[model samples]
Target: MKRIVEFMKRNYKIILVVTALSAILWSFIPREKKEDPEKDKLILELLTMVLERGHYSPVEINDDFSKKVYHKYLENIDPTKRFFIQSDINEFSKYETSLDEMILRKDISFFNLTNSRLLQRMKESRKIYENLLSKPFDYNVKESINIDYDNLPFAKNKSDLVERWRKQLKLSTLSSLTDKQKLEEEKKKENASYEEKSFEVIEKEVRESTLKSLDEYFNFLEKELTRDDWFAIFLNSIVERFDPHTFYFSPEDKEKFDVSMSGTFQGIGARLQKKEAGVEISELISGGPAWRGKELEAGDLILKVGQGKEEPIDIAGMRLDDVVKKIKGPKGTEVRLTVKKVDGTIKVISIIRDEVETEETFAKSSVVEKDGKKYGIIYLPKFYISFENKENRDAFKDVAAEIEKLKAQNIDGLIMDLRDNGGGSLETVVKMVGLFIPEGPVVQVKAPRRNPEILPDPDKRVQYDGPLVVMINNFSASASEIFAAAIQDYKRGIVVGSKHSYGKGTVQNVIDLNQFIRSSSFGDLGALKTTIQKFYRINGGSTQREGVKSDVVFPDRFSYLDMGERDEESALPWDKIEPAKYEPLQINYDNIILNSNKRIATNTTFKLIDENAKWIFERKDEKVISLNLNDFNNELAVADEKLKKFKAISDYKNTYEFKSLPDELALFEKDTVLKQKRERWHEEMQKDIYIEETLNIISDIKLLTKGKSLTQKLSLN
Candidate 1:
């Protein structure tokens, strides 16, 4: 091993120089600027070759596979059934079997046919929505609309398509009508003269809004969507067939993805997805303006965006990227978003644009006292590391430093918070896991055409040997699962939280398409992230579909929700391998875990969480929502009434006073806003039932271990 290390050290520079020279030489090669339509085919050919050569679990590209890809692409394109008709489907069905030939031949016939048909249908549907909206909708009429469009069939003809638009337009206009009615009621309560507008006038105004949105959508379709634009979508359709995680990013999109992953970006810090009505806020970045403001939520639908006192421009039908462009601007600017809540309430919220520092990405420490015993909680959002800059701070180093700080604080116990930490650097995580265990195999990596390599902790020094616990949830994935699994297998710590962490054990490397194309100038060929490896625990169990099982499970709101790796249709299957050489280091986690489980069973906080989980699942199950204003309002009230019981979950607290490490307080002193944010986090810490429970478990561990050294205690077990 020493000889191998010496050889690697000696040859590293030579290898790097050779790689650099290869890249430099490749760039200098003469290339043609081709305007040929066959460029996409060439890209597809290269992508297929790469997937075949590099993919860990390459799937067959047979006729059956081609059919699945065709269906998947169609589902992705017209998921809501708003555009395509039965005849269009019939026309596209001819290539249902021929897609295999097309994929093999790189033929553009299928894409051209579908693209032309979609464009034609879009043009025709634009007129239909306008013609139907010319007349006022009858709100008094008792009619229901099922928005579960995927389960429903496409329009049979142009008349059928028109009816579809009519129902859709009414649903949207109905929301506006209800909002307007509520406004008038509030105005009346304030004794303000509310000009009574006729229902027809309100309907006309709503229709005009819809028209403006359609015009904007079509304008974007005509101008921005080039022939090359859909190629990325087409490529993505092919790559996703292998697995949901495998993806293609256009050069522009790759930059966006990089910016997003950088932990700080000058944007609203809310992930958006296009829905039927508007751009939905998929998630709010922790410590971002959106999360700090707490006005927007994950499920909130953004209808319009107003920039610095500008008239709110409707974003109901706008593309997600376009909406993102409008929402993201320079720091210190203001962006107002008109959002519709889950309960059908519409309101406009203003957010001051600023650099959203993702505190969750880096390791942060806060002291919490339980039963006269102080414990340090290391909240790790991700296994973050900057590959471009070796000097830039990484999660592993920061986490170790934090542990040192906590050690100086004389923390009786340590709890590593890995909840919602969608994994980052694998090397970082292995180093991080070493912070607890003295030395052992952290994870086993099995790559294509390579032997399984057991990644062990090089450091023999255990940072903290106190009663340790690792907290994880359904969102904890990849590297997060690796650390948790290692701890669990080694019996070095107690793993708590959800039944399992997110089962994303696969590794991906983004290959630049432009770099692969020698002497070819096809503009930007984008990047493809392909899964080339899978991770396994020291115990040999793959954390693929069946993620690392928690030592002590706790109920949460996402417990019943389909939130794990197994929930995804295309997720890789879980398997097992030969267990690595590692001995259990835990003393008596069974007793401690049993006690914790009992507490979780009877704890009021958990009971509230259990009830909340059920309520959430029930909400998710209800696909067909009422269109009637009264019924809709009544159902929302019923849901709220039932959900009221679960409000105590977040309100529940224990005797734990949380404070940031003294080193971090200096930064807060300079930034008043950050100080307030930290204060808010500290306040929330008090109410966190999960952390409180973890501290209780730690206190029990300390009591159980008694006067024995942590190493001696573990060795005895």
Candidate 2:
């Protein structure tokens, strides 16, 4: 550890010196002067108009304040600029006082503060003004002006007398009601006809309702003031001082996010979700310790966790983060959880936490048979690999191995499933794409004032030569986009799935918190994730706001949800540059769509999807009926009947006759589908209809190539 610290100290000083020099240079630098006075004046006029519309009082024109803000704005605009130079900065500085005056007078001509730096400065100045207005005021000693709780002027001072006066004014306003207020006051006029005694009953009901409302308001406030909330807010405040991408995560959130990103964690292997009753087991991760134990099942609500059955720790009303911390322990430790099953049975299950290896998250392959032809299917959960670790375990290498194994089995075609894969290592993605096509430009990257550079495939050889199809969905993003773009650009395979992928093109670098505070007065402030660069396709279009559009599209339940880059707050803007020149791949897959549409039109599974979507849409927000025992039983029966009908439509029995293959071929096929329902499970794995469509396309490609080969042989004969 000491050696490691020494090494970092030796290398990190260079970065510190460079950063310090840049900051010092920027602080003293004179920036460009504004050539367009009209533009500058328009910006100022706009700011004034916005202030007036918002009912914000303008700041008094102070030359010192204006000059200080203007200089700060210049520094923000071009932090690297040094020496007394540049006309734009100088010109903007010259009109600083005039801008302040225009803002103070609420001039209509001020409307052009559109630049980011200028906007930030204007916001800061407005905040200063508001802070000044929010100061406590002395309401006790009033001149002739009317001043009460409801009609008090903005305060600008803090004093003990002011607090007493404000409280006194609030009490007086309640005591002395105005004519308008009295006219609109709540009255028991309806009860006057009934009796004077009935007024007491009405008053009690109104008081109870008001009390309930207040109780709910305070409950919400209490929940909002949790330790986690305060910690999150503090972290955010610290991160906000730096770039928008830089962030801090508490230990719990950090653990969760790390688990999601890496797809590995120390747990019993059950996926949990917060349900109405308690944390319920959603699914059992295959090959996990929990799955091996077979003691826990999906839909079992965990009520308590305990050690040695000594009084269980009730987890009701506990935050998910807190619950997770309690459940996660070192490997080999046994933690018992009392669960309530859906069938109304209670059971205590002891689970041992262990390191769950997530092979499912990597590349897994299977053979699919449709219309008496076999197609290889490779499901890649994410383009993930820990590059920092010395262990060479990588996604690209694993995927390449899977492809080679499929090749050895003499598969006719291939389907690469990328559905719900929210991307990872950019280096791995480029290498993965290289497995299909000969080495060429896969992507391009550009930064401010820098020429765009092409990121080419590092390898020169193709791993698989047979027909190929790439599957994607709405959740597919970043590295996924890069892979899809490369495959599309090369025309090496059919790109099929949702209409567009999740457009997350920005790259983030995780800066250690300890490293950041090493030279500062504060020690170990926590980690910071800073956005370093952006990703672009080889075609010059960014996959930022506009993700990759598929050649064939499929429907998904989450299609209506706002889940992409455009929906994200503070996402970077999308733009393009000159297209990089490259020859497109020679493969043809136009017939894939024609065949897919025909199959989908007659498919019963797809028909159920359409019907279910319509049903959900119609009953999306229907309130539950408060029914008696008989009516409740009747409602449950109706719901069960509807579910049965939906299930029937989706259940398709296999009717294709099996042919006896050669002994070697038979063994290979048997081993692939040794488990019960293997064929059906493989079919469901191709849930994205567009991916199924792609597989069909690959089948057609194989036939077309085979036909051409036979024709050439006949011609030679």
- Candidate 2 per-residue lDDT over residues 1-717, each given as its tens digit: 000000111123235533554454345322444333332232233223222221111223467545544443333322322111233344345556564564455342322331433334323433332332233322233222222212232222323224333343222222212211222333435344533334334333333433333333234334443434333432332232222344445544555655655667887876675533457775565556776675787657786666543434545444445556667777888878878654333567898888776765567677667766777778776676775574857789988988887776677888888865667777788889888877688888654345777778899788886677788776677788889988887777678876788787766554443331114222223343444457688888999878888886655443444446765433567888777887675445666667776776687776666565455455433333322323433444575576676665445434322222233245655665323223333545534355455656777777766623211112211
Candidate 1 per-residue lDDT, tens place, 129-231, comes to 7787777776666677887765888889878878878887777677666667667678777876766777667667777766665666666677777776666
Worst 10 residues of 2 by lDDT: 1-10
All candidates' lDDT scores? 0.75, 0.54
Prediction 2 global C-alpha lDDT: 0.54
Error of 2 at 560 (Å): 4.0
TM-score of 2: 0.56
Q: Which stretches of candidate 1 lie over 4 Å from their true place?
A: 1-32, 190-204, 272-283, 298-323, 333-349, 358-360, 650-655, 712-717
Candidate 2 residue 111 C-alpha distance from true site, Å: 33
TM-score for each of the candidates: 0.90, 0.56
Candidate with top lDDT is 1
Model number with the top TM-score:
1
